[model samples]
Target: MAEFTFSTEQQELRKAVRRFAADNFDEETVRRLMESDPRFDPKVWARLGAELGVLGLAVPESAGGVGGTLVDQAVAVEELGAALACGPLFGTVYLAIPALVAASAGAARDELLPELIEGRKTAAFAVADQAGAFDPAAVTLTATDGDVTVSGTVARVVDADAADVILVAANGSGGVGLYAVDAAAAQRTNLVTLDLTRPQADLEFASAPAQLIAGPDEAERVITHALQVGSVLLAVEQVGASQHLLDIAVEYAKTRLQFGRPIGSFQAVKHRLADLLVDVEHARSTAYHAVWALTDGSDDPALAASIAQATCSAAFSRVARDAIQTLGGIGFTWEHQAHLYFKRATTDAALLGSAEQHRDRVAKLVLDTAAVERVPEVAVGSPR
Candidate 1:
């Protein structure tokens, strides 16, 4: 087993996030958000975004950020997942900002990055159609005349209503490109989504004007960055959900008696819970590796990301289902909150890309790298 160690700063950040989530984003707040029309409480979001500076964690110092890395952001993601809060922070901060930072340079980045760091503007990655195929080549949206006109609709975008800017991936002259579209110019139709807590929308661009932020090849560049960051961050969130599920299951097992004693004392329950612990720990190692690679500029960030996403997705889903089973009848009730975590876990597992997709990518990457190693270098006239 790999050992886990955290720096003092990382530990402090995690503690602060845990306290904030526990205080503000409890079960009652989550229920209220789910029931409400717009979905989240603005005050709580402001506190998280503006007060705590959660949105700026991954942004660089040149862009007015605190100069933190993906690992720092991952720590906060865990807390947010644990709370099950309904906010646009993840979509804006994790997906959009990272993509922008990775893709743009010069004047555009100078103008956009600072605004994002300050939380004055919100951005979303407008990938993924109704089919949930997040491929760059699968994008049906079109951007013509270099940057002037954009057409086609993007389905199921996270936090589309709150966005000031949207990073749109579309088919352009030289292959797939990324454009920074001003949200006010486009037509946004809010959708009745399954996960009500997280607001989603369908956006239409009828020859909408956009700025050419990233030229051709930008879609792959930006999506790769988004996936690399999201894969690890999503795993952190899964860690939080899995831990929360375990805690809930343990408490329920202790209080709810079966066969005259606490059900937790049963060998079957004990073994199952023990197995869950092992899965969670395994996920922790892979997630930590992914974050570390992203932060340290490792050679294989994408491969690390695929491994983490695949492992963490499985761990979270299993933990969530087992938790529901452990709670028996009450877990199935709408009033009970176990189902909320379960649903969120399911949705998040399929975000960015599915676990099966990631596994396939991982396999190809490994084989490709192995094949590259078989070719021997020849010195001018020396070796064949």
Candidate 2:
């Protein structure tokens, strides 16, 4: 098999996204949008989809997308994460679009995919609860047929208030299914979230009209696949954020002086940054491996994803918190951009699943695989 390397096109795409983020996602613009009612600029989003083609970066061209690989999509998402972009990209592209594409072709997929790729509309995926449980049994909302009206509530839906449509997992007579509900038909209440850049909303529905995207038998498969794919992408995002935090902290250490000398000259500060550098680099390595595993149909994609999520989650959370400590007083202030990244890092650690959850999952997968293979348990991470 060929090595997992970014093509020139992918590298160029990353540069383009970075440039776009630099010009459009300045601190002032991000702060303003974070406090605004809509939370993001639609025109900029349209440009991202229509002009830059970031939204459809990985969608199959046959499905009216860019016909690129998942690596291409990751490149764009990482840049967005670094920029702390305030947009519907995470909910729409990562969650909703993947679910729609995975489901068998139908009215919802045929109609919504184009509009979504063109950035004319936005969507939210409510497959997981606040705890990040996405199993069929984890779903609470119930859907009934004969026009398919769903009743119940989906909590912690990313960008639910800004979504034109919501792809939800609900229990019905057909068992757990994926349903597409019109956002306007549901009650959307924005939450007081720690991460203002990535706003979330709670959605309540009382027999809201919907279309079944994927039925019981296939819903679980589709949902699990989406979750794993999302996990890999999310790990990549965490790596990007960690990189950003490290860069800022290192720069601050060099510039800030104490006792007539740069604080970076101090032994304690150097060790702190050196440790953070290891964490960030490990995060990037693990995340990239997971991305490769998923893209290449590796045997242990689940294991790879869990490991990546576990490592990246802890790494980003640590980097974000330590960045504030490194920056001293300015990092904790509301006016400084450090708080913004810190908030995002803290929120992201819990978004898909907590690091502890992922660590538990990784243990389960490794042990289960070992049991199947009848391999001797040689204490992992223990010296012989």
Reference-based lDDT, each prediction: 0.76, 0.82
Clashes of each: 0, 0
Which candidate number maximizes TM-score? 2
RMSD of candidate 1 to the true fold?
5.4
**Where is the poorest 10-residue window by lDDT in model 2?**
375-384
> What is the per-residue lDDT of model 2 for residues 277-347, given as tens digits with 9 covering 90 to 100?
99999998888887766665543656777788889999999999999999999999988888888888888
Point out where model 2 deviates above 4 Å: 1-3, 129-133, 369-384
TM-score for each of the candidates? 0.90, 0.93
The numbered model that scores best in lDDT is 2
Lowest-scoring 10 consecutive residues by lDDT in candidate 1? Answer: 375-384
Positional deviation of residue 266's Cα in model 2 after best superposition, in angstroms: 1.5
